[model samples]
Target: MPMRTRDSSGRRLATLAVCCAIVVLVLAAVAMPVAGHAYLSDSDPANGDRLEALPETVTLEFSGDGVQVADVTVTGPDGEDVSGDAVIDPDDDRLVSVSLERDDTDADGIYTVDWEILAEDGHTTAGSFFFSVGDEPVDRESVLEAYADDEDDVSIATTAAKGALLLAVVALVGVPVTAAVAVYPVVGRFGVAPSVVDRRLTRVLAGAGVVLFGAVLALGVARSASIGSSGLSLEAIRTFAATPLGHVWLVQLLVAALVATGLLAGVRGSLDRRYWLGSSLAGAVVVQATVSWTSHSATLVDRLQGVTVDFAHVAGAGLWLGGLCVLAAVLPTVLADAEAGDRDRLAADAIRRYSIVALTGVTLALLTGLILAVWHAPTLAHLAETTYGTALSAKVLLVVAALGLGGFTRFVLLRRLDPDRERSALERRVRGRGSSGRGSDGRVRENGGREAGDDPTVDETASTTSTLVTRVLSLEVALLVLVVVLSGLLTSTPTAVVAEQTDAGDPVTLEREYDDGIVELTVGSPSVWGEHGSAFVDEGEPVVFDVTFTSASDGDPLESDRPVTILAHNERADTQLQFDLEATEEPGTYSTVQTLPDPLWWELRVSGSPEGTYVSEWVDVYAVPDGHEHVHEYAPLEETGFTHLLRIGAIVVGITGSLAVAVETVRFGRRQR
Candidate 1:
């Protein structure tokens, strides 16, 4: 009884470990995905808040990992970067702080901060926020508009290059390893061992691998060089050679060299199976580890776990899918000339042997894939709703379908093969269908369409099942290739967890560029932004009309403090409103307590020249009637509530798992006693 109890406990523990590892990884992945995307979390002055005056230091707090401090510019009302000597704190790089050296803080207008940051997840997030000193409340809608994507769209050529590089890396590592582990072993067992043809193929693939890696290396160096420079060139390699990413890229070059060496050894007939496996394994490790450092894994709060899972996932995918490439291409050729009996035996043996390795690889790849998916998307609905999620879902379906075919080949179809028999039933069936025992009758049919694996020549019989299996296998391989393509595309897509909500009402913002920076225009309604129009203010029944300007180029305020004038025209009612807006205490804001005579489509146009260039903006404000006096609620500028739910889920799962372990242990102890 005592021995039995220990064995039971051991089995249970093993089960628990596997289950817990997968569950815990997934929960931890989801736990902090909200912060995985580096975003501006907090600011010293706070967005839309009015400050008494500018402070000596301007600080921005970011939530997430891999926040690269590209630039932190604080534009005062004068449309210039007031943020002096931007620096990241050594202790906490997420905290970007800059000094405000000038007295421009006294100006009454919206003070803007423009930020450009690179998240380690290979994405760039650029945005601007406004805090007022003497001006009206910063119109967030206008600010968002001004800060919209005025920059060029993400480079299409760059994305294609990245995709090619990713494919090359996967094949570079996967092909040699798969060959050593699966292809060579199976083909060698069938007496079609590695030969000069194989060697030549390896040589070509190795050369292609080296060339591909070189392209990737060049791109990496080019990216490093182009970070703050004007363009990409050979000159950038000198600068790139010094950066951490550059160092990692160099390490990848070493790994690529190993891959080439391994392939070359096989090509030269000097390759031991162990040597090829070991070299490919080492190369895979370096490539996986190095890529993970700058990619999605770097953004995870649990860096170690994330990186480990990433390595496993990437390596597993390369092996499983890449191996299929070798199998699909080389399998037919190997079995083409074998006797009917030998062909059936050989095909079944090869597939069944490879199945075990494939199953393991597929399982790890899928589990890790699920873990990544859960991290990037808060819910199943999010996956269905988001493009990234949709792509992932398609990839998952493809994997499942391919795996199903693989299982069929390994189990039902292969198990039925009896190599000892004189002729396999599959070949027999094809022969039975014909007048004579052969693949072709040497006669044209009325339909002019060939039967399954049937030919016009009578000399040889065709096995329909073999052809069917081959076709199925080829389709499965094709789907897996698509899966890799989708994975590459995903590197550029935004996860559902980071997508912003659009329920909040705001105007389409616009931007005007200046020498130092760009200014943003956020449009707001009278109810949310206007002053109390009950007193001395004239024009219609005075509502508060405010114009908030924030600059992304520099944290300077509007250079001119002259009385701001804006003309409001209602084309429908044939009415116009003009306000000579006085400069509020805010540095770059012009405002007056005013309203339109009757609520209609009112166009408010303001023109100003802030240091760099002339700029004009027209904003439309719609005031609806229903016994007015309505105040709008500003959208929360922090993370969505969904992130907090994931946190709650993690806590719940952890507690449950712990309790389960405790309960199991206690039960076992009591039984022993």
Candidate 2:
């Protein structure tokens, strides 16, 4: 009776183990890839070059994703005012162009360009550069590009290191959880494989949390380097360290140490303390929360959604992988015993229970994954067209395949292998075979020996089958990791889109030489001509300009097509008025405006030409605060505050969420202990 009872328990436990293993394997195979692949590449102006004239647009290029141009600014020499317009390229969503007014280019000095680009992968890259105009010399020693280069290098290094660490942690933690679930018959009373798997997986998830914490620290260093700023002073460190992101690394380090210690102690048989388990579990949860901050989950609402999805993702992965470990190691051992019937029954029961749990985990994984996609992507087009989206699709497909396998194992195989009925039939077949060649007693002995002895063929077949299944599941998990790495890359801006949309077409120069004695003015308009006129302007209007002057050679009223007149309006008004002077008949410079209405208040006025008129000779004209007398130019492109905030917010949220998860995990462990 005692042996039978033990056999029954063993069989039930094996069944539970198989079921949990199936579910955990499926989840891991699906979720990890979806999380890793996000990043950025390429930018406009080609890094560094001297421009013949200022470019009206700035664009960026990416390998496989798309980007949103957040902002662009141009500051001229003397830090004075210049005519410039910033706007998105109508033809491409990724490009951002800025157009400067022709009149504002009078100052000959270096111009600084600063910009920000947001990638589809939910991260942002921002930096500044400078270029010389006219006769101004370029600064050869500037480290702006070096800083930008550092940003990319540091980000890649940090992400890779962190990702590797996370993978290791997940694997280590999952091992124990899998073992626990597999050995549940010996450990617990009920068929709660799903709950057990979940609990164990959660504890192991702390490994990933710790890895994420490391990533946050690496990112901060990268950010500081990119900015060309230094001073790891207490204040600087505190400023960064105090944030949810800064503390994530510190927390992860502590949690990792604790988890390692606990795991080692447990392995050595010295740590039977339940607190170790609790601490490990709590630490993992904290890590999950802290790492989430590095994602787009900084705000309360986003964080809540992120937390829910992340939990599902993490827990699902653990359960799937851990369950597989059990099915491979523990189930067969219990099945090959003398009281095979009872052992088989227990194993079958456990398998049945585990199937349900795995199904639930897979379901949660799918739902949460979809929610995350919807929240972050926001558009179907983005999902279909972006690199991030493509990786996500691949991950989804793998998950479906895993689910299908699980379904086959559950509904078809489990039902057919019904221990209550099948055991009897199998027993009859074996007994009959044995009886055909021997006496009843001899046949019974032969049957018992066959069941008890370890035959190479039977063992080989079972191991081969289990190994094949495990290999397939492991492949799925590996693909998931690739998907995650791609996701990280996708988060970076798409240089191609930005380049196409924001590149300034060609420069159109219109020059007019006026014989003004007092002012030898060679008025010129460097207009940006593109497929669309507004590509080079801020007010979403075409680039337009006007230049006018008066004659200083002769202090006499000049002739006009209709008449010649001078009305002195102010002391600063041009003393000599000339109109219709013998200037060459150019399309934009045919006629000139001369005259003033005196008390010396109103200056000479030229009407009728869209590009404005130029005086034939040099004449001093008074500068007016609100006057349009000299030359007026306009480039139409406008930037809104909302767009700026949106891009900035995305970057902040992503970085912050990643760090927060790390810190929370540490705090959780401390409290638990």
**What's model 1's TM-score?**
0.63
- What would the TM-score be for candidate 2 when compared with the true structure? 0.48
Stretches of candidate 1 off by over 4 Å are 1-35, 101-109, 135-158, 200-208, 218-222, 225-243, 261-277, 336-341, 411-468, 501-673
Scored by CA lDDT, what does every candidate get?
0.57, 0.41
lDDT of 1 by residue, 630-652 (tens): 22111122334654564555445
Lowest summed lDDT over 10 consecutive residues: which window, candidate 2?
629-638
Segments in model 2 whose C-alpha atoms lie over 4 Å from true places? 1-110, 115-124, 129-154, 165-182, 186-244, 299-301, 325-350, 412-418, 424-537, 540-673
Per-prediction TM-score: 0.63, 0.48
Clashes of each: 38, 88
